[model samples]
Structure formats: C-alpha cells, structure tokens
Target: MSESYRVVEPQTGVRIGFGDVWQRRELLGMLFQRQIAARYRQMLLGVVWLALEPMAQLAMLTIVFGFLLRVDTGGYPYPLFAFSAMTGWWLFSKTLMSVAGSLQDNIGLISKVYFPRLILPLAATMKELFDGGVMVVILVGLSMLYGYLPTAKIVVLVPLFAYAALIGLGVGLWIATVMVRFRDVRPMMGLVLQAGMYATPIVYPATLVPERFAYAYQFNPMYWVVELSRWALMDKPVDIAPPFFWSLGFVCVTVYGGLMVFAKTEKIVVDVQ
Candidate 1:
C-alpha cells in the first residue's frame, strides 16, 4: 500500500498572500456583510449611529480643545481643521481596534474554518468604508459651511484612506497574532490608542509642537497623514521632507513585516485559542 502526505506552508511572499485573499474575494465579501449585519442587528438607530457617534465626539472635542484649552487652529475654523484630521484618524484607529480583535472575537468560527485568516480583518475593515463615506460627507458639508469649499486636492483623500487603513492593518496583524498567545495585548492596545491620539496632531495643530521637537514628531506616521489631509481638505501647508519619507518607508516595512509574521503564526493561533 502507498500513502501520500499533504503539506501546508506559510505564505512568505506578500504578493502571494494577498493574491490568496483576492482569490477568496467572495468569502471576504460574505464576511463583510455578516459583520455589518451582526453589528447593527438590534440597534435602534442602526447605521445612523455611525454618523451620530462622530458628531457627538466632535462636539465634545470642540468644547474641550476648541473652547476650554483654546488651542490655536492657524486661522481656520477649529471644527473643520480638526474634523479633517479626525476623519482619517478615526479610520486608522477603528480599523486597528477592529482588525486586532477580529481573530479573537471569532475564535469559535476560526477553530472550524479553513479560509484565509486575513479575511476577518479585511472584512472588519469594510464597515469603516461606510463610516468613512459618512464622515467625508460631513467633512465636506462642514468645510463648505466654514468657507473652505472643495478643491481638486480633496481627491488625495482616496489614497489617504488606504494609507490610514494600511497602517492600522499592519499594526493590527502583529497584535492579532500576538493576542492569541497573550490576551493582555488587546487591552494594552487601547491604552496605546488613547496615548497615540495626543501624540498625533489631531485636535491641535502641528505648530503647537515646539520647532526644536518638530523633527522628532515627524517620526509619527499619522502626523504625515493628518498634515497631508489638512493640506488636501483646507489648503493648509504640508512639509514632505526627509521625515515624511522616513515614516513612509517605516509604514511599508511594517505592513509587509506584519503579513509575514501573521502568515508564519496563523496556524498556531488556532491551537493557542
């Protein structure tokens, strides 16, 4: 009698791994729909909550940063200036949290499934597209109200959205792989996000950082995203300097590295969970 053995290998090539994801695009779409349904199944306001949540947050931010601290906004209306950055930041932060928790949240299904593990995070990312679309409308409306009418530069937001998602997915993939072994990493990420918001120039302008420390601040990936977003949305100034290039290189390294790490460890995650 002769027997044959089956072998499975890690997806080491970024292109190969993503190609697998593409091949399973239908499964990805199904998961995206399931996620959306599950999220709003019983909520009273349903998808409208997506719009409400940000507006409520913007109101509080306007009071705290715009009123209490009286942060300078470089002559633009504070709401427009802050919301422009907030739109991108929200996409990044929510994607990170959603993707990071995806594997754990669906551990039961993951234990039984033989699909591309990347699908869960990618599905989680889909809802953010809806949320982002809503935010963009609000942003445009706010911009016009503030006399910062739409410009051709606004088109840059298309890639900027993808850039923000890439950053989140990169970091989330690393965390998702780790959290299967160390659940503590999940909560730690929340603290990191909270701290990260203050570190990035969102509610406050970049100028608030003293000129001496400006170079170091450029190390922040979102700093580039926010500045570029403001420039695109409101014609604010942006410096595409050495630091911007460094952060861009760092982001590229991060996303590719995260994919490699996730592919290496994905099989083991089920065993640990």
Candidate 2:
C-alpha cells in the first residue's frame, strides 16, 4: 500500500487540507454508519425512532401553538407550514445537539486512531440527514394530502437543507471545542437548542415578533433556512432573495470559523480530554 508521509496522524498545527480529508473519505462513510447504528442501538424502536420523534414533536407543537394558542400561519394550514419550517429547524437543532460532543464521545477512537478529526463532527451530520430525509418524506406526503402540490420550486429544498447543515456544523464546531474542557456545554446546548426552537418562527409567524425585534430575529441563521424552506416547499409568502444571500454569507463565516477553531484546538482538547 502506498503511504502518505506529509499527512500526519493526530493532525497538528493550524493547517488542515481538504485533499487529506478527501483521501480519507472512506473513513467518513464508515464512521457515519457506526454513528447511525449507535444512535438507535439501544432504543426499542431503533431507527424508526428517528422518524417518529420528529413527528411526535411536530404533533405536540401543533397542539400547543396550532390549537390552544391559535397562532396565525396565514391561509396555509398550520401543520404543513410548521412542519416545513421545523424540517430545517430540526436539521439545525439535531446536528448541533449531536456534534456538541462528537469528539468527546469518540475519545476511544480519537486516542487510538489517526483520522481527520473534522470527520467526527461532519459524520455526526450524516446521521441527521438520514433521519431528516425520513421527516421530509412525511412532509411531502402531507403537502399532497393538503392539496398543496409541490411545484418545480420544490427542488430548492436541496440547497436549503445544505444551508441547515452548515449552520449546524458551524455552531457545533464552536460547542465541541469548548466541550472538551467544559463538560456542561453539551447539556447546556441541549437546553439552548430547545429554547431556540420556539425563538425561531417555527411555532408562530414572523408577524408575531413585533417590529423592534424583527431585525434582530432575522440574524438567527436557522430563521432564514426555515423561511426559505417554507417558501420552497409550500410557496409560503416570505421575503426571500436578501435573507437567502445574507444567510449564505453568515453560514460561510460560521462554518469557516468553526473549522478553524476545531482544527486549532483539536490537539489541546485531546490533551485536556
């Protein structure tokens, strides 16, 4: 077998090459599979939980905001509207929740093996995509049931899903770096993500946010993803173009910074872990 001398194990320094990561692409696939198996291993329903859990959450939200509170979702059916937005929100929240401990969770592998550390967190996202696809299938079925036939614009969900993953990875990288030393970060982010769900326009419409906070609310990266996704899936009336571009800019900055922080601190975290 040919060996690469330049690529060192336990990647050191600030330098991380995309080529090196690509060379180990098989490792990413393997790790991602392991993550999927492990995630649903002990649960009674196994992989089915991935699909059910999101549906269950959507049901509860639909009850609270859709019925009791009677939140306005325009003329669009609340369940369909909420589910479309929640799909992206779920991606952002779920990926970040797992990735917060991606490295620390794999301490055994990290200690013994030399692979791209970036793969750990990126791999965390793969399982989410699988689970998210399950939710999307449900969404598509529901849209048809509601007589909101998907148009050619439905293809736009591809990029919107990617945007969600980037947001998750970016926030996850920063959280994972701190988590190596501060164990509390993992649980704390869980609570934060829980709160972030309601904070976004998922449970309610953007009109509910009063004029003053609306500007600041748009800064939430997932907000744009949810809005864009709603527009793509259901033709929901949301101002796009600008938020789409701004969200892209925000995610680019976040993912780049997250990767940098993770790369720079990878060694120190292993030492600390």
- Residue 174 alpha-carbon offset, candidate 1, angstroms: 0.7
Candidate 2 residues 201-239, lDDT tens each? 888888899999888788777888888788877887777
Residue 98, model 2: lDDT of 75
Candidate 2 lDDT at 34 equals 86
Per-residue lDDT, model 2, residue 244, is: 59
Q: Which TM-score value belongs to model 1?
A: 0.92
Best-fitting candidate, measured by TM-score?
Answer: 1
lDDT of 1 by residue, 50-167 (tens): 8888889898999999989989998888888789999999999999888888889988888997888888888888877767777888888989998888999989988988899889
Q: What ranges in model 1 sit over 4 Å off?
A: 1-16
Clashing pairs in 2: none
TM-score of model number 2: 0.91
Please count the clashing residue pairs in each candidate, in the order shown. Answer: 0, 0
- Give each model a TM-score: 0.92, 0.91
